[model samples]
Target: MKNQSPIIEVAELFTISENPNLRIFDGRTGPNAKEEYLKKHLENSVFVDLNSDLAEIDNPKNGGRHPLPKFEDFIKTLGSLGIDKDSHVVIYDDKNGANAAARFWWMLRAVGQTNVQVLNGGLQFAENQNYPLSSGEDSYPETDYISGHQDWQLPQIWMDDVKLATQDSGSVIVDVRESQRYDGITELIDLIAGHIPNAKNFPFIDNLDDDGLFKSPELLKNLYSELFENYDQNKITFHCGSGVTACHSLLALDYAGFDIPNLYVGSWSEWSRNEV
Candidate 1:
């Protein structure tokens, strides 16, 4: 079943905590993410490592830092997490939904799993709301995740396609990295600074309010509709430093009731390495 929205509030999550088909995931990243989760996490939420579970990392020059895993491997990963096709999956990260949580949500949606959502405001909001938390690891009985789609169902673009789109006046490429990185001011992660040619800078943070939660759907619709009014959704592409945080904006667009756009998984990371 498709969720009413891609973003789920902590209050609503409380109501569905007891749903037999519900599965919660802690999709935090960083060197100490597992340690942090072991210290404290949403009750019964299984930890999903970004590097090992969500991405198939290799040479960044080829596939970026966080390329989507193979479909068969991903299905096995879902099963290992005890997530079946019918599971109502809720994912969260400490950095709001801009981290691996949104990536996981995007991956699930791409695989035709519609009952998944990112917890709005992420772990911080849930903690502030006094949602139940548990220490140490949590486990669930593994199941075979029967998936009908053998490939990713959502739209995605390769580096060559993005190059062609850049030449098209009607197409738009959105860079969701911070303004500093986009503007060549300072780049802490990638080797090169500055954004792709003709790409527009729209930091992923803009999708959130002062409270760190997503802006209302109506507000988001108005904001993005104007920016994307002239182009067809298929002609738009969203990307970030390594193709992870880009999903944050994609999730926002989905919440705003717009069709999801193309994700350039081999984003700036791969582009910078391959290009001069």
Candidate 2:
């Protein structure tokens, strides 16, 4: 297949209804994503459960909840999805690139797959665009998904480093949870809040609007001016409830053409469990 393809446009992804290269994956799982997707989804898109296929569970002793899958396991999942190394992966969810699409994107980058992108604003945007929808189980021929070299490029910083860097003037951390969650007003996930002490709060929702589509680059530029225009990109780290939504922020930053930084995948979920 010499012909290459980018992610499907919001219009085509829904309107055309079929694209082989544009693999629209339902990266929406939070105990309900699978059921909801089964009920309905963008036509021709495939479903991938985050919990089962994407995670390698960890023991309570190891402190990793939903640990990353082993290399072999990852290869298997890609194979089952009928994706090859060069597959142009486009993952989306009901939430604003939340759910687990960002995680799916991160996992793709972690393995050196560079063509992955999050469906900014996600499923709601598709519907808002008046894209067609279908509800049914679709199957595909099983392809021999070959494993390639592990090209781990995405970085992961630990809580210990983040703690020490709080005093480092040049370092910054961005908490991607909702504003109330960041302010400790809403304690949904972690017992402690106020966002890693001094990390800036930019809820993932800001990346999109009421319609669930991303704002224009100019608007995004002004919104992220303080963070992207002025600071060192590598000095930044992102975190959310469970390390999933944080990637949303990172993806937005990348879209804005700023330096993409490491993600603290342990996030608050794993961080709160630590002594720090």
Candidate 3:
């Protein structure tokens, strides 16, 4: 699959609303998910649940609330969705690709299916553009995807990277989580209340204003470019709990035309499970 960078503007999607190979995934999730999806969504988009699709079964006390799912089972799930190595997948979620879209994007990339991308503004933007939404379920013939053993990629840094960055004083570790979570004021998902050892708190929410619209790309560039002025973009690693919301930062970087960095997939949630 020759996957060109597939970041598309809201206007661009209209050009290919009828491609046979195109598969759009509705990645909206959480308590509001099923209801929101039932109300409205992109026409012909398939639903991929977060608790079901993006997460693995786990004991309640485990570090990960929704851990990564098993491979064979995940493959079976994808196959039932009519997805395969040859498919050009477009995934999106209303929560800025944070909640579940990135999860599907990661799954596609993990399987060597490079022709996958997260919709920039997600379903809300699509609807705002007056794009059509359908109440009917998306139905397509099932695909029997012949699985290839993929070179498992871990383009992630661990606490080690954090420690090294702290000691050596080279690149910065930016936490893309909320400020409350960063300040040790709230312990939503982890044992420890504080952030990574020496990381800076640059919540992804800061990238947006009150309207839920992202700030101007130039403004974002001016803001973050100064914030990360001392470091090369590749040397930086974007992360959030279980490596999900961090994609918002990755998206932010892309919006700024900065070099995309490695993702620490297992963020603080995974880190909290480890013993020093």
Candidates' C-alpha lDDT: 0.94, 0.71, 0.72
Model 3 lDDT tens row, 1-276: 234553555676677778888888898877877777877889888888877777775752353455567777778778888898777788888986766876677666666676777776788888888888987567556888756854434355655665566565667777899989888899877777777777788888877666565667788889888888888665677777766787677666656666657676667776666632
Candidates 1 and 3 compared: the better one by lDDT is 1
Model 3 backbone overlap count: 0
Order of quality (lDDT):
1, 3, 2
- TM-score for every candidate vs. truth? 0.98, 0.86, 0.81
RMSD of each: 1.1, 3.4, 3.4
Worst 10 residues of 2 by lDDT: 1-10
Model 3, residue 269: distance off in Å is: 2.4
Q: Candidate 2, residues 1-276: lDDT per residue as tens digits?
A: 211221235754554345466567888776667778989887667898777777776652233355567767787787888777666677788877765787787777677676676775678777777766789865455567665665446777877787876777788888888889887787765656656767888888888767676666567667888665556767778888777778777777666655568787667667666643
Give me the candidate number with maximum lDDT: 1
Q: What digit string (tens of lDDT, one per residue) describes model 1 on residues 1-276? A: 335799999999999999999999999999999999999999999999999999999999988999989999999999999999879999999999999999999999998898999999999999999999999999778999988989999999999998998899999999999999999999899899988889999899999999999999999999999889889878999999888999999999999998899999999999998874
| Model 1 lDDT, residue 143, Cα | 96
By TM-score, is 2 or 3 better?
Answer: 2
Which 10 successive residues of model 1 have the least lDDT summed? 1-10
